[model samples]
Target: MSRSQRPIVAFLYDFDKTLCTTDMEDYAFIPSLGMTPAEFWPEANGFGRENRMDGILAYMYTMIRESEKRGLPFTRADLVEKGREIVLFPGVQDWFGRINAFGETQGVQVEHYVISSGLREIIEGSAISGAFKEIYASEFYYDAAGRPVWPKLTVNFTAKTQFVYRINKGVLDVSNDRDLNASMPDDSKRVPFTNMIYIGDGLSDVPCMKMMRAYGGQAIAVYQESNRSGVEDLLAKGRVDFIFPADYSEGTELDRTAKNILRRMAISDALAEENQEQLRAIGRDELPNQARLF
Candidate 1:
């Protein structure tokens, strides 16, 4: 198929647990602060609860304060350097390439994106950072001296939904709210909801998963052994379509299910296009009544 003829399918993922084994900060950032994950997370949560601050911002702030106490530099470079220590889940390192290849063979153009509450700079430092077309996450703005000063962006759970819309409209720039909110025709949008899939781990991802369910997309929850029951709850509640071990290895349930979804979306796109063509053939401008087909 020609470039324009190929249907575009998007895979949107949460970074922390969906792709990696644990929270991004647990890898190296917390350790560098001379604090364990147990201590750091609780303190951050406590601060948020006491001050009525957003949890994501509270953690970012805690990072800066703790770094200062330890005489560690909280520069963008420092945080990114910590990302080097992140350990991705099994098969994650090669998952994108294989999925992209499979999509190509299916006449689908695959695009990957990360909508996370973790630090964007840290994700940028990871080995698979370049695989995503866009990474929407919390970020800190540095001062003239290159010291972290303020939160540039904080993507809490609910805020994650906007990035889904951004991906749908191809308005990737986080700073551009005007165009993101502008009304646009469904067909004119870049990628249809039906062609999108969202993969997330837990509660922080509920809003995005719900968006996928409400809209025509598919949502998958990947879980670790410790969180299997929580993930089961999500599936039982019909909040997600499927749950799999946080493994992306070839032949794994996740890998197979993802491919199946891609194929289904590809077939749906083809059918919708053929229906439109049939309408145009008969010189009818009225929208085809076959919306139920796709």
Candidate 2:
């Protein structure tokens, strides 16, 4: 089938603690700064508090300041190197391809994306970076000397929904505000909200999750064994549609759930196509049910 004929299903994920065992910084960057996560977060948060800065910007600033203070390189390459240390949940490396193939069998095109508050450079270094069509996250501007000089983008919890809208509209370029903001009918969107699925961890994911739920997409929360209670609470609060263990291993609850969602979306897409075809057959394709009076 042609690309235009295929139904597109997008799966958006949060990086830290959602796909991996812990925060991305906990793996290497913090340690390289001579700080433990426990010691580093409070300092970062305190700096944000004292300076009245956005938490994402504050942390990026802290990274630069500390790295410069210690005479560390603190370049984009340094971040990519640090990303090498991130450990992923079971079967994460293979999960994308498996899901894509499953979507093909169900007659849908599955696309993956990362909408993370973590560092884009670091995630770019990850083994699974190839899985995503786009990875939106905080990043830095490097000087001619290749040292990180400034924060280029800071993706906080509330701002994540913007990327979701971008995905829905197929406006992946972060710089194209004109296209992103232009009004488009729901049916004209490249991927309607109902065809999207957002998978994330707890609290920080609530805004995007709630947006997905409100817009007819699926919002699923995945938790670690020790963190199941938090996700359960999210489910209980009706902020998310489903909850499961973070295990991405094939046939696991999370994996099974993902496949099921894809299957259901494919069915919905097929039924909608059939409805359109029938309408065309009956000369009702124009369906003169406009709210406006001619």
Candidate 3:
């Protein structure tokens, strides 16, 4: 289908456990500090426990402190380079293209997005980073010397929900245009919530998953096969539209489910458009009668 005629279907994903099997930092960054995941997490958690700090903030602080102690460079570029080593789940590299191709066949435009609490710089280093139209994730600020200075943006569970609205209103930048978020009518938004599909795992994604589902979007709560019990729990609670194994293989449950969703959304959009055109034609036909009275 031509670009002008394509119906938009947005696939919003949570990183960490959703896309990658493990947390991105645990894959490379923590190990690069010469500490095991267990060791680093305990210390980080201890600090959070002692200070009553947010877990995400504590982790960021731990990264900076530990990197400094290990004499590892803590620059933005260094973080991005570490991200390059982050491993993805099975079939992830081809998942985007496959989904996009399916969308094309269904006359829809499949757009991907990342709404992650993970560091943005590192995600940018990932092989599949180019697949997303926009990434809403935590990021650090740099000093005049271009060194990582501080966390400029920290996307926690609730904060990540804001990006959902931004996506709806076509507001890409996090730093500007407050009115876009505050005053834009729902009808004027770029993509309706019903056109969205959110994929996530675990508790950090609960708020986002709930928000999407509440707003007419579908949410999938994915879990490893070994963790079928958790999937059952989520399904019972109605927290997700569906539950699927974390497996991303082509023709797997995930792949087939997503394809079916796109097809359904395309049919809905086509029907809506047909109705609109019929209304216009009716109005045109009635114009002659109204003009005769005038």
Candidate 4:
């Protein structure tokens, strides 16, 4: 089938902890400032609490303040360079190609997206950055000299859902709020919620995970040993449909489950297409018999 004729399945991901082993900053940014993860996070979080600032903004500010104090490079280029230090989880480097090939065999178009609270610049510089159609994340507004001046975008847990809608409507432009907020029929959407799969980590992912459950989409939480209990709590609370180890290797549980979801969504798309065709053939506005749809 042609690209437009094929059903589209979107795989949405959280960058930190989900794909990478830990927070992206922990890999290189924090250490470059002569601070450990232990020292930085508490300070950042504490700054937010004390100033009633948004946590993401607080961290961005802290990164700026600390780096400047240490006479370190705090330019956008500097941040992107830090991305090179990020260590991905098992098989993540090959996961996209494998999943995309499987989607082709099933006659569906697969797309990847990063909906993250991490720095967009950092994610853009990662090894697998090219795999995604779009990376929606917190970002810094840089000056003419390439120094970060202010927060251009800040994606907290709740803000992540906006990217989901953007993907659904094929409105990838971040500046186009008019089209994003405008009414459009569900049938006219580029990708339905049923064709989306969201992969995230723990509590910070709850809003997006719950959105998946409430809609027809699927929400999966991947955990490391350190965060297993947290993800388990999410599962128990019915916020996530599945919890797996953060392994994306071929034949791994995450890989198999992702392929299965793709297959199921593809079948559902085919059935929906057939139903529409039948309705058109019968000159009916809707199906004559609701039971005719399986």
Clash counts per candidate, in order, are 0, 0, 0, 0
Best first by lDDT, ranked: 1, 4, 2, 3
**What's the lDDT for all of these models?**
0.91, 0.88, 0.83, 0.90
Look at candidate 3 and tell me the lDDT of residue 225. 70
Candidate that beats the other on lDDT, 3 or 4, i.e. the better one: 4
The per-prediction CA RMSD against the true structure, in angstroms, equals 1.6, 3.4, 5.5, 2.1
Segments of candidate 3 deviating more than 4 angstroms: 1-3, 284-294
Residues forming the 10-long window of minimal summed lDDT in candidate 1: 285-294
TM-score per candidate, chains pooled = 0.97, 0.95, 0.91, 0.96
The true-versus-predicted C-alpha distance at residue 95 of model 2, in Å, is 0.4
Tens digits of lDDT, candidate 2, 75-131: 788889889999998889999999999999999989999999999999998999989
Query: Best TM-score goes to which candidate?
Result: 1
- Return the lDDT, model 2, position 107: 91
Q: Show where candidate 4 strays beyond 4 Å.
A: 1-4, 286-294
